[model samples]
Target: MAKILVAFDTRDEGFEKLGSEHEIIRPPKGRDFTLEELQGLLPEAEVLCSVFDRPARAELLEHGTRLRLIANFGVGFNNIDIDYARSHGITVTNTPQAVIIPTAELTLALMLDCARRVSELDRLVRRHPGESTAIGRSGYLGVHLSGKTLGLIGYGRIASAVASRARAFGMKVLYHKRTPLSPEEETRQGISYAPLEELLRLSDFISIHTPYSPETHHFIGAQQFALMKPSTIFINTARGSVVDEDALISALQSHTIAYAGLDVFEDKDIPRLPLCQLENVCMTPHTGTQTADARRAMNEEMLENVARFLAGRSDLDRVV
Candidate 1:
């Protein structure tokens, strides 16, 4: 049997679906692996599988002589040191298409919640007991999403899905992407291309679906925040580093933007940020890809990448 080191443990259900042929080395609860420990167990490990764990770099890959592919359980491979792995001929893999719908749905849900202040009101009704705001208050109250301009920072599969849902709510969608979509995609999706500044200025709601990279780091910063309307709501379902959290916190604190909804934060730990200090920004843990259907899909896809690579087929999750 080819020994495989599972850096982090996935649920038993996911493993069972992975089949029983390979010998898998599972990590313990909350136990982080040192280079020595990883080398000790599965010394001849051929493939490594994980969800969020990052393996030791440089010497670790050199030490892992038999390592061929790294099948990551999640879509983002940021946790792993990809550059070093690739240099040593180790193919890096990740589940990409599986979590699209789940993430898109969560993005829409967060947008609506921010527009309507749904979660706060729910908390008020539960905790306040007797005193409550008027249920039908208008004006500065809950804003209607219909007939509003929606801006997408990155026009990708998830953004297209969000646009579809927004269209159902009568939203006019605007997008800013490095490469614009085709004419059929524009017509079918009911979206218009705009420069980043123009889209930011015109949009009543700004949503980020961009991937995290050097070019995308701080895609939304002080300058970008200054361009948005005070009535606008900002939503980020992408990576945390894609946005500068300090700028977001300052914008919301100063009421430069009316409200913000974030499913992912620049920091993985949300409570540590000043986001909770404001009542306007609705925050959630990085749960955009956490739906049951999406989890199942990601698990299956991740395993398939491992299987495909082991079967001497093209590496499906090859990022490097």
Candidate 2:
């Protein structure tokens, strides 16, 4: 039997449902797999199933002679040093397909919340002593989404899903991406490709869906915020660093932008930090891919990668 080490916190509620046959070693602490200690407990393990924490590093791989796979419980595998893992002959895989709709749905939720100030209104109602006729009129006045231009920063699977929902709501969909959608996809999704600058300038509700890469680091900064309308709303379900945190704060302070709905923070600790002090922003944990169905799917897929590897099959999610 192959030994599998689960290094981070995972309910793996899906694995039990999948009924896969394997010997699993789950860490006691939900998140105790620090680099310094991972190898000591899981010396003979053939796989490292990682959750939100960072995957095995080059130095850490020295303790991984038996480690053949690093199955990430995520879509973004940037946490793993791919090159180093490849050189060490360790395969990496991530659960991808299951989270598409759930993440898109969350993106839509954030976009709508930011546009209409949903979070602020909820806060308002809670602070007031009671719901009253005067309070209803004075508390919250939000914008409408119908007939608004909905901008998407990426045109991948999740972006396409968001465009579909936006279209159903009668919003004009505009996308700024590396490549134009195929003519067939454009017709199917009813979306138009626009220059990044044009999309930034024209969108009433701007949502980012791009991946994190060197080219995309801080893709939206103070200059980008300056291009938006004062009435514009911002939503980010993508990687946190994609937006410049300091620039976003500056823009919000200057009232250059209306509001922001963020799921992931540039610094993941922003929710507990001074950034959460602003009333114009709404944040969720990095939970776009955290729906029940998505979570199970991620867990199942990761385990299957492990199962297949032990069966003498090549690792399918190899980063190298």
Candidate 3:
């Protein structure tokens, strides 16, 4: 049996399925394993159950003398050094199927929160209970969603799910990806493919779903923001590094974009000063798939990857 090192503290239900055959090392409660803590355990670990918060850099990957598989707990594997792992003959996998719906739901939630100013108004009522300023029709006006153009930055599973939800709300969906879909496929899904520039300029609501990589780092910056409408509502459920936060702040401060709803940020924790202080923006603590159902699904998928890899199966969810 292999030594499985769990770098994050997920619930024990899924891991319990491994029985007493394999040894599992877990971090302390309420925290992820630090790099230093992980390094000490790497030599004996044949598998690593990784989370997105911690960086699985080259130094850590190199220390895994017995490492065979790195099963990431989330869909996006940006936090792990995939190239280095492959170079060292180690396999890397992620729980892609598990996060699709929950992340799409979070994206929709953020979109509605920004468009309706839900969180801001809720906070207003709570901070000053029974205040008249919080009331009246003209006091806190917000945008309506029906018949608005929604642009998706990536045409992945999560983005496809978002498109379905957007269509239900009478939103016109446009998507921009590395490769445009054929006209027949577009017609079937009711989503039109547009060039990046056109999508940026025309979309009233823009949702980013692209993965983070060297080619996509700060993919949306000052120039891209400049192309957007002044009344645009921006939503990002993807990695924070995909957009330049400094440029995003500049746009928000100058009203270059009307509002932003963000689930991720460049900083690992709470965002920088001006973003936190912005009244026109709404933020979540990167809890895109924090629901109990999604967590359980991710754990199951991760375990399946570990099981398949150990059994010498090639049909598993192998990303790298």
Identify the leading candidate in terms of TM-score. 3
* Cand. 2 Cα-lDDT: 0.81
| Residue pairs in candidate 2 whose N, alpha carbon or C atoms collide under 3 angstroms | none
The stretch of ten residues in a row with the least summed lDDT in candidate 2 is 12-21
Worst 10 residues of 1 by lDDT: 9-18
Per-prediction TM-score, please?
0.90, 0.89, 0.91
Per-residue C-alpha lDDT of model 2 across residues 1-320, encoded as one tens digit per residue: 67778887777465552244666777675565666678685678887887655756667767877887888888788778788788878888877776788999998898888767888878876877666435456556777888999999987888889999989888999999987978897888799999999999999999998998899999999999999999888988888999998898888878899888888788753553545788888888878887778877778777777767677787566555
User: Which ten contiguous residues of candidate 3 have the minimum total lDDT?
Assistant: 128-137
**Which residue runs does candidate 3 get wrong by more than 4 Å?**
16-20, 27-37
lDDT of 3 by residue, 1-320 (tens): 98999998887767766767899899888988888889999989999999876789898988898899999988878789988998889999998899999999999999999999998888887888666654676877888789899999999999999999999999999999999999999999999999999999999999999998899899999999999999999999998989999999999999999999999898774588999899999999898998999999999989888888877889777889
Ranking by TM-score: 3, 1, 2
* Alpha-carbon runs more than 4 Å astray in model 1: 13-21, 27-36, 53-56, 130-136, 268-273
lDDT at position 52, candidate 1: 59
Candidate achieving the largest lDDT? 3
Q: What are the clashing pairs of model 3?
A: none
Q: All models: lDDT? A: 0.83, 0.81, 0.91
